[model samples]
Target: MARGLIKAKMLPEGKEVEFEVEKPVKVSDLLKMAGLSSETAVVIRDGTPLLETDVVKPGERVEIVRVLSGGAKV
Candidate 1:
């Protein structure tokens, strides 16, 4: 089984966390393992947006970030 590192910026606290997991795991799975919510975060692989069903390959760096909402009322 292939393995790689996944790093993410957790919301609320805004702290970064890193972990290693087997390759081919869904983005959802990565979120679960990283202790993040799938609804609030976006997964990116090698600077490309990856779907939850996308498989992460070995040696690939993944960044899961929480989407921030902000707006100015007109």
Candidate 2:
């Protein structure tokens, strides 16, 4: 089986992490490989948001932004 590379840019730290996949995998799978939870992080490619069911192609770069939900109740 061939291996594919998925480059991810993590938020807050603005660090880049790379993961290897056997082939094109779903966003959920990619997250699993990266050890990130779907509820806390969102996957984006080409400035567009990707769903859990969306497929991430080989050698693609995506950003993983952590969801921030904090506001004044006022």
In the order shown, the candidates' Cα RMSDs to the true structure are 3.5, 2.3
TM-score of each: 0.64, 0.82
lDDT of 1 at 57: 57
In angstroms, how far off is 5's CA in candidate 1?
3.7
- Candidate 1, RMSD to the unseen true structure: 3.5
Give the per-residue lDDT digits (tens) of candidate 2, residues 1-74.
37878899987569999987888999998888878899988999999999999998878899988777577777
lDDT of 1: 0.72
Write down the lDDT that model 2 would get: 0.87
Displacement of the residue 9 alpha carbon in candidate 1, Å: 6.3
Off by over 4 Å in 2: 69-74
Candidate-wise lDDT, in order: 0.72, 0.87
> lDDT per residue, candidate 1, 22-58, as tens digits?
7667888887887668888878865788888887654
- Model 1, residue 38: what's the lDDT? 81
Off by over 4 Å in 1: 7-16, 70-74
TM-score (C-alpha) between model 2 and the true structure: 0.82
